[model samples]
Target: MHGWLTTPPGPGPHPVVLIIHGGPFAQVTVAVSDETQVLVDAGYAVLACNPRGSAGYGQAHGRVIRRRLGTVDRSDVLDFLAGALADAPKLDAGRLGLMGGSYGGFLAAWLTAHDQRFTAAIVERAFLDPETFLGTSDVGDFFVEEYLGPSRALRNAQSPQELVDRVSTPTLLIHSEQDLRCPLSQAERYYFALKRGGVAAELAIFPGEDHELSRGGTPRHRLQRLELILDWWDRYLPVRPAPHART
Candidate 1:
């Protein structure tokens, strides 16, 4: 699960964010961190992971991803991030963020449930429910079978809806209104459930948009989405000034 780490300006005690790369096989590392400049500029240490199942390493690593989404991959995310807290000295361990798009979004939401260490989370176009996703998703119909196996129950177990109750972290879900890959309704379901459970959550749905909101959406809207994520983290994971002021 080793990925890459980007250094930020200034010294110790800066907020840290784990940027998970999506795609059952794609790899986005520290070298691929242009989208994270805003987080770095806002004084946050960014840890980008390619994880166990990400591509570009070899077929051996990438092939294990089939039918192993939440089981092994999720563990890699939580455990690797928890380990990074000890290694990255400049990072403020107490103030943390989890962010990504699509499969990365699923990792963010899954981390919200599996790990309590993250102070805040930003999930974009997340495949919230793999069961429903398989049924409703336009693109998922073709890819879900490959990654999740032929079992619907496996997809259910991989879904955030199956585990959303375990999440209490403040989560911000960003998605497109017309995303056929994951569907905006998936985000809606988690948003409503998180609110119902009294867990802090919000969903930002961009109208007339699709799955590639990250690359194809209006520039202004994407900027707004980025700002919203930073603001969410600041509100929940702000750094403590001193030992006594930390309360």
Candidate 2:
């Protein structure tokens, strides 16, 4: 339920991006994030939040999302953003972007599907379909069963792909071809569904990379990833020009 918001200089109401962290079980601490810096430099405010399911908040908080992937954790993220916006008048509520990797991407996809507040979203290395994840991912079977239960029906209920039909925001899917933790098929399936449903969507697959591409991929690939993300935001949720700079 805690997070950090980094804003660009001379912000009078800058577009904001809610950046979620991977490992629904991991905690996001205050640190120098290269992506956050990149976004801020491009005139976007970045809000990195650690919700209920995140670690370092005691065992009970982290376990609350067990068998409830998109429930409380989803609410915590939106609620946190609401509170953040209310407190920071310099952040525009209309132009909001969402991006996350892995479990974070799951929540981002889940939220944009149900909530129409986001101007755009980037889903990277997401665990989208629980049923397919059970066999494809290195930890799929245990992770899905443990977090979503073993029932096929229950798993489908929490799967983000099931709700893809409802998404209206333009979305970008970024994935690694060799990701064993969340196979490339996850992004492909969602991309196909999104396009068929008439939503603005694009999928970018990086070769020779895995699930850890964002954290451990080669420097060149990582730079490319950053450029891709920035380009997506620029197209869909562009930063408004400052009043003084307006022609």
Off by over 4 Å in 2: 241-247
lDDT of 2 by residue, 131-178 (tens): 889998999878999999989999999999999999988999999999
Q: lDDT of model 1 at residue 140?
A: 68
lDDT of each: 0.80, 0.92
Model 1 residue 218 lDDT?
A: 88
Residues 96-150, model 1: lDDT tens digits: 7888888888878877888788778888998888777777998767777888777
Instruction: Kindly provide the TM-score of model 1 when superposed on the true structure, using C-alpha atoms.
Output: 0.91
Candidate 1 Cα errors over 4 Å, as ranges: 30-32, 239-247
